[model samples]
Target: MTILNSQHILKNLQELKSFWQDFLPHLNDRCILLMSGDVGAGKTTSVQMIAGELGMRDVQSPSFAIHLRYENAEGKAMDHLDLYRLKDDDDLESSGFWDLFAQKNSLIIIEWANRLDFDYLPLNWQRIEVRFEKLSDTERKITTRQV
Candidate 1:
């Protein structure tokens, strides 16, 4: 299902939280989530809520560090990666991007993922696309696959 706004994504997260187990029965290790969206499209905000659902405390975006690795008290590490600067940083592929896929209990969320080459991304990964309507603050849409 494709949610048409930030609030819609929030609602869907809550709705899907309880039923998450059903969605991924054998889910284990190194999950990848590619979240594509324009600036201020709630990409970071959605990740924060997912972290909250996973019992992660104090979620923060690593847009500056290029990547963030945060593990809550539960030892579940969520890597929030910002590809916003990747357009210029051509050496990112060799700088530990591939290393993250080898980790267990790691969930990576790549914002502005469209900039990266598809070959660098994992196959069969979950994808989400966010679009804005016109040029307004409240105009946005989020579409997901294999959620």
Candidate 2:
């Protein structure tokens, strides 16, 4: 389901979080969430919310670490990857992200995902685009491409 041109992101966020909790139970493992948005578009904020919902206390951007693997109280690990520093395709190639894809039961949220080529994406991924609009600080347009 794709949400296009939303006026209120906080409301949309409530819905998005609900969508995850309501449907994610059936998946029984990890899922890739490709957040296609520019800086300050709430991608990191959304992921932080997810981490909290998953029972994690801290959620920080791994801009320097490249990736940060967080574990739930139940031992489930969520991998958060930041591609903001990657200058070229070769940087992505060196990341060996494909091997990381093999890790099941782990959620991967990629920042600056649009910077990477589609060929590197997993077969199953939820693409989310957030566009800021209007003078209102809280309004945004979000489009989701779910496969």
Candidate 3:
């Protein structure tokens, strides 16, 4: 397994785009990107930025819909999921969350992933930990880790 712990400070959207560009080549269809952090830690923002960089325009939070799928700039399928409302495994099962894995060529990004039990998650997936550090009233830092 590749244990990666990389950090980047994103002060603006341009920096976020550059970071995604650098990380794009490392992503693949079988990867599930689990994002964990406190509320307002830029998890959705990160997803939106990555989606935008990958050519998904009009990206919005999937908190209400819980799941969304789109084609990236390369025409690759991308899945965005939110687990904030899931209360248990039965909820997940009923929601057909696991069914998403059946779809090929999916690069899934999940928000509020910390709410789920990690042991039940698919193995060999990438876990990204995002932490928002307040530097000032107008400035903040987005730290990311890949494991």
Candidate 4:
């Protein structure tokens, strides 16, 4: 199910906030948000904005840590992952990527999700794939769909 397919100029915070408003309704617990985009394409920024909207503060890119867990005021968990450094399934295993699925209530958000193989995902899991395309220095084309 394609939930959002739109483009926006993300040059300022207001534009990003507007985009978050449009994207927030489709988000839910116990789902995986797979994001793919070139470096500096706003994938992590989008996550930060969404996390802020969810009452989370100081959300940072998990690029160095590979994975980071956050909790909102309501105790909802969101797992942020960056797969750019992972090379293979062994690395994923070592990073505890698979274990995240066991957390039924956490929202898993993966950056560099193009590196992940979809076949390994549980069939019953709800997955949302979001793709970001850099149109210009301040614009991005964001497409999202449930898969």
Best by lDDT: 4
Which sections of candidate 1 miss by over 4 Å?
1-28, 89-91, 124-136
Q: Cα RMSD (Å) per model?
A: 5.1, 3.8, 3.0, 2.0
* Model 4 lDDT, full chain set: 0.82
* Regions of candidate 2 where Cα sits further than 4 Å from its true position: 1-28, 124-135
Q: Summing lDDT over every window of 10 consecutive residues in candidate 1, give the lowest-scoring window.
A: 1-10
TM-score of 3: 0.79
Q: Residue 115 error for model 4, in Å?
A: 0.4
CA deviation > 4 Å runs, candidate 3 = 1-4, 124-140
- State the local distance difference test value for candidate 2: 0.65
Clashing pairs in 2: none
TM-score of each: 0.68, 0.74, 0.79, 0.89
* Alpha carbon deviation, residue 96, candidate 2 (Å): 3.9
Give the higher-TM-score candidate: 2 or 3: 3
lDDT per residue (tens digit) for residues 1-147 in model 2: 323222334445676576456534543365676666667767787778788878987799988777788988899878888888877767766776777777755777787777766665666544333333222355445555554
Name every residue pair that clashes in candidate 1: none
> Order of candidates by lDDT, top first?
4, 3, 2, 1
Instruction: Report the number of backbone clashes for model 3.
Output: 0
Looking at candidate 4, what is the lDDT of residue 102? 84
Worst 10 residues of 4 by lDDT: 1-10
Per-residue alpha-carbon lDDT of candidate 4 for residues 13-128, written as tens digits (9 for 90 to 100)? 57867888777777666788889989878899989988988899989988788999999878988899999888778878888888888876777899999998777887667788
Model 3 weakest 10-residue run by lDDT:
1-10
Q: After superposition, how far is residue 78 of candidate 2 from its true place, in Å?
A: 1.0
